[model samples]
Target: MDASIFSAPKIDCHCHIFDPESFPYAPGVFYAPSGGEIATADYFMQVMSAYGVSHALLVGPNSGYGTDNRCMLDAIRRGGHRFKGIAVVENDASASQLQDLQAQGVVGIAFNMALLGLAHYANADALWERIAALDMCVQVQVQDDQMAELAPRLLGCGAQIVVDHHGRPDISRGLASPGFDALLRMADSGRCAVKLSGYDKFSREALPFADAQPFTDVLLSAFGPANCLWGSDWPNIRATRRLDYGTLLGVFERSVPSEADRRTILVDTPMRLFGFGTGGN
Candidate 1:
């Protein structure tokens, strides 16, 4: 009998929680997620329970909340070991604030270069160094060839890096794309991990995102099982179409057919990267 994908302990390495009702959106943000884009912590926990997902690493989104991490902080506080977080902060945010976040269960800082632009974080090297000093990771989300420019510093920053969305590679440019190549090269440093998710962000085509598969294949090969992880990208914002959680899992299941690989991506890697354990709720 085939092993069930639902039977194993799984962790979602990237996802977001939007609770504007309790934590209002930051004023004058460029994009505010509403309607289908909202997922309260309670709702997400139920969804996780339904899918047999044991824990999720909730991201502090740039869209609505910007540098305000109260929403995600509250969720982590209430989640009872079921949630960990990556927070968003100003490039010049102080060490005290970051230490406070870390004390509250945030494991990393988010660099949403895709939304905030590269220029915004050009002076972030010191911030990265500080994050590394605290033993936390930097969660990066870059689009097109942006990572090519940032990879050099990020690799040298001494922080554990978790890259978003298979590097959000420009599939039209193929594996030879400079940005994608740079992202792949970061694997050699052993401090980088990539998520197999957010297909809608880079894929020119629909559903299984066939155009993006070559990039994903290269990522899986280059990053290897230990550095590769799975994420639902829950509460997907600005999506071209509706993306169901189960459907997303199915796409990942099809992409990686081997049960051993699946377990590594779904359970083991996230455990190592996000600090989830079997003892947790």
Candidate 2:
């Protein structure tokens, strides 16, 4: 694959940083990565540099560290201009705590419904107002069937909505998935954005993930390039086997195929949403 596509500065809208020694995994964590591979800010930066990624959104890994965002915040602080973070906060968390998180380079809050479920957000409305006041976006990782029910509720909170993992569609069911439809509607309203990441998680086929193309096509069409952001989903934990970062980038190049569109997905969209170069508060 031609690596020229990555020569321009790009933003990884989703990725993680973990340090079991400094920020130990939460007891009863869903998935604890063994062997300490790809578990530090330095290692992730090395991989990003190798792929020509200039900036990234360090998402709080809910499954590994639960609601503890210290590792994510530490990574962003150390990464300087190269990183921003999405923290995972308790639904009833105080506004003062959110202010502290925002000061720590966190640009958003994460709701990993895929693992934690909707019940995790019992105080979502109040929390949304707090984050919104700070000009932060809400990043969500949810199952395919949850979109229709969740999108409206999120929109009601009045914060920008960012749906993760291609809306995590059930490709086996094609576009018939109600959640996929809801996602498209959300995108159409210009109130939500979708991360064009995690094809490996949703793809049923082998490498190159050609099987995920149709879903990508629909997303690009529905969300348009301006609202679609690309990410490496680095250290793809759920991958059955080792997956190369370069190969994942290649998959995105093939999936989108338009240099202009790729530029928006890879750079413009995320920068605008996360307020990277704008010197966001």
Candidate 3:
């Protein structure tokens, strides 16, 4: 294996920490992360260290802890500034509650429509307003053509939209698909960003998804290098294929071949987007 990827400082824009032992799974949860899916904050830091990842944006998982951000809050507290977060909140979350999470290092809110359908957030206009008012972003994970419906409302509210998983495009439909096209149009908004991640989420093929390169190309062109972020959806929960931290770094390397572009995606962009200091945890 090549050891060069570890030589640079990198921030994982998206990852998770599930500690069912320290914090038991909440009741009425969608799914519990037993066995291989379980990953404590301590374990994730160790993994980051091993793979040359300096910091991470810890996204609060919807499963096993819906609207209860305590587990994620705990991880940010213990992470010692090495982690920032995107929290999941109830539709009617108050400003004070958002301030509480922001004070603790949460920079955004996660609206994972890919897991919870679009209709679940139909009445979220107020939520968007709150997130924008607090200077936080809406980190959205929508599949296929969903972006078309969500983009106008998101931009209309003046909330920064941080899209997840390369817009989770329908690969068979090609790049001009409604959702991805709408995503590209967002480039002009100066308020949208897409993660150069989650190849396994949409790709019909395997890891190191060559099938997704064309889409990646247009996204970079649309959003530009600065607006694009990279994330490792670590622990591979609810994922069909195996995912490794190191392997993902390599995939990123291949995806953006330019050294300057890679530097921006791996370090500069995230450091600017989230508030991560240099050096590993």
Candidate 4:
């Protein structure tokens, strides 16, 4: 694999870490952490330095940690301006709470709807207004089947939105998938962006991640270089085998070969989205 890809000052836009024992997931919450030795801020920083990633956008995981972004926030604080966080708070968070989270380094808020089920955010529009007022991006995880119904509401929010895991599209249906088609159209309208990640969960086959290529290619063409970002979906839960981040980056190289495009997905796009190079620049 190419170690050069891990060159310095890289930005990783999506990652999660939590101590399951302390956080204690709530019942009825749709997703659970696939147990692994807990990964902490120090561990993340060590890994980031090893990968030469200087900045990261810490997305809160749906592991029942709910609204308690303490560990992640602490990590950002200690990372010393090298990090930003996307908090996971209840949709009904008070105005002051949102403002305080912003002060704590939260740049966005995420709704893990794809993993938790869309019905949970039936009031997404209302929630969007609060986050939008904060000038924070809204991240939603929607599977391909849910796109047609969800995209319209997402667009109506009139706020910047990020769709995770290749729009959670169903590759077996190919281009005919209405959900995927809708996402492509949304990307074209310049209203949204997507992450090329979590292929292990979406893919039908095993290693080398060949099953995920077609979907990744479609995203490249639809979102173009500027709107696409790549993520390792590190410490992936669905896998029976332990997959390393280096291998995931290697998978990206094979799937999207254009150096220019790779730079956009891995470097340029995230830099812009996360506002890299601020005085922190």
TM value for model 2: 0.94
Candidate of highest TM-score: 1
Q: Compute the lDDT for candidate 4.
A: 0.76
lDDT of 1 by residue, 1-281 (tens): 55777766789888999998999999998889999788899999999999999899999998899899999999999998989999999999888989999999999999988877999998999999999999999999998899889999998899999999988877777788888889999999999999999998988888877787788788889999899999999988888987888888888888887888889998888888778888684
Best of the two (1, 3) by TM-score:
1
Clashing pairs in 2: none
Q: Which stretches of candidate 4 lie over 4 Å from their true place?
A: 1-3, 20-37, 238-240, 278-281
TM-score (C-alpha) between model 4 and the true structure: 0.90
lDDT of 2: 0.82
lDDT of 2 by residue, 106-180 (tens): 888988887777776766888887877788888888877888788888888888889899988888889878988
Local distance difference test, each candidate? 0.89, 0.82, 0.88, 0.76
Measure candidate 3: CA RMSD.
1.8
Q: In model 1, what lDDT does residue 66 have?
A: 89
Instruction: Report the error of model 4 at residue 189, Å.
Output: 2.5
Q: Give the per-residue Cα lDDT of candidate 1 at 212.
A: 74
Better of 2 and 4 by TM-score: 2
lDDT of 4 at 91: 71
Worst 10 residues of 2 by lDDT: 1-10
User: What TM-scores do the predictions have?
Assistant: 0.97, 0.94, 0.96, 0.90
The prediction achieving the highest lDDT against the true structure is 1
